[model samples]
Target: MTGRENRRGRSRCREPQQSNHDVCVVPEEVSAHEGKPLYVLVALWCLKRGGWVNRGQIADAFGISERSATFQLTYLSRKKEQICCELRKVKRAGVPVESYEVRVTEVSPEAGVRKVSEKQREAVKTIQRGRVGNADGDVRELTRNIWNSLQRGRKA
Candidate 1:
């Protein structure tokens, strides 16, 4: 066995892992950029993980400062319906850590976002069928009614 392997246990995987996930490594091409390119990498990571991905993992994978990682993550987190970024309390190695997750899609309804109910779904279907050159309802009133129907539920 190598001296380093002897010093550290062989079972210790060098790859960063959280829960059951192996963190994705940033591509060498990706590591070379500072702005939008890094943003793409962050987005890809979020999409791949399909849940919350942490900053330390991104930093280590890309050999970047956690600050840079945070900047990139925060940038992508702003695009609604595309990416959602939020701070969450998480336990890492049994210690609580403030973590961020960039969700590519909304798994849960966020604040200021509404969920559609049976009524809204029915309204939407009616709207779709009526939209084929038969839109007789006042646009403003129809919009308000649809909006109200969507916001009246807890995503059942």
Candidate 2:
């Protein structure tokens, strides 16, 4: 099946990565689809809030159906280990069915992406905005440089 068709029916993504104010850039071979950008944005928004976000909230925010929201959230939960997020069902008074919530976890170290502090996040954004290197350069080196600088500051 073609990539678009595959994505319209699929409910998962490759090793998911999250950044600020930009689209995800997974390898094309394992890429999920164009909608991944939405998912990443929503997930990051939820992360910044420092609280669980429900399916209804995500649906309303993205203007998608609850089912579709669930799919997007499920895709993220599937990569929870990589993304440091988890899904939980919360009970509401007088509601027969429980709704889902996404919560960021503290286990980001073992995950694919390291836990980024607010200061570090801002620093990375500043460095990225001032970037002058090859656009296609590996971001790992950039992350490493930032990390080294942060470590040195801590040591001094």
Candidate 3:
């Protein structure tokens, strides 16, 4: 029997070879963020791939809707300086699409950290200051307060 064949005479399926670039090194901070884990992960994925990642690719990789992926990409593009990525809008097969290219393979300690404005900080404080009582009414009031605070912040 040939070395390539197993005892049953069927050829073994070989695993696809991977280059050094296929190895993705995720930083602690990327996964540490309570929020925006998908955004950070998509950035790292783009960096590891070293190419333009479209919304469909992001959606496939993260198991999210294409719109959600686009939103994350848009957010990253807006914060390109903080995230170290580049965004390009191009037409694929005559359909306009957005793609992201990560500028760095390695993430810095401060990467992806957004600077909170004082107004946003005050809003957070106001939400946190609400008392959490055992009563259902108290919980509803707290929820309403948080929702109102968010709406006010959005309007400002």
Candidate 4:
């Protein structure tokens, strides 16, 4: 298949390298499609939310169906070469469904091109879960300490 067709069908691309100044200069081969700018923008939007986003969200925002939203997300996550994002089913209310997140490793090559990775995909999920859990744990501990202090004051 042609390169663009290959990307559309969800193929991988070469990993990009960081420049001396630490900016990522993604090679041109990353995103093969010319119409992926909107996809990348939406992906970034989802990533910034730092949580699960369903197909419905994309459809409502972009005026498309769940399937088309999925297709676009899949194409960007799987097919586009340079940008790396993660999509997985996180259990919510006992239903298995798709949600997405991304790590901003670089500026997109263009508005119509997005580059992402399979390796970092798993990392994205783990990192987000870990961050949230850690924050929750901290809050719980702080609350317990405060309660303990209040009890001591009452005794005094």
- TM-scores, each model vs. reference: 0.38, 0.43, 0.45, 0.38
Give the clashing pairs for model 4.
Answer: 30-81, 37-111, 37-112, 82-115, 82-116, 83-115, 83-116, 84-116, 84-117
lDDT of each: 0.54, 0.60, 0.57, 0.51
Across 62-98, the per-residue lDDT of candidate 4 in tens digits comes to 4456666767667556644555565565455766753
Candidate 4 accuracy as TM-score? 0.38
Models, CA RMSD each: 19.0, 17.7, 15.7, 18.6
Winning candidate number (TM-score): 3
Q: Against the hidden true structure, what lDDT does model 2 obtain?
A: 0.60
Off-target runs (Cα >4 Å) in candidate 2 are: 1-36, 105-156
lDDT by residue (1-156, candidate 3, tens digit) is 112433343222122133321212223323333243446666766676777778777765554667777787886676555577666656558657544433434434566567899999999877744556556887788989999999999999
| Winner on lDDT (3 vs 4) | 3
Reference-based TM-score, model 1: 0.38
- Per-residue lDDT of candidate 1, residues 1-116 (tens digit): 11222122322112433354333344433332222334565665565566767777777655567887888677666655644555455655866665675555432223223468
Candidate 3: residue pairs that collide: none
Q: How many pairs of residues collide in each model?
A: 0, 0, 0, 9
lDDT per residue for candidate 2 within 1-156, as digits (tens), equals 123222334332323234323222232322333343555655665666678888777765544667777887886787755567878888899999888888855433243334679999898777756567664556868877899999999999
Model 4 alpha-carbon miss at residue 46, Å: 2.3
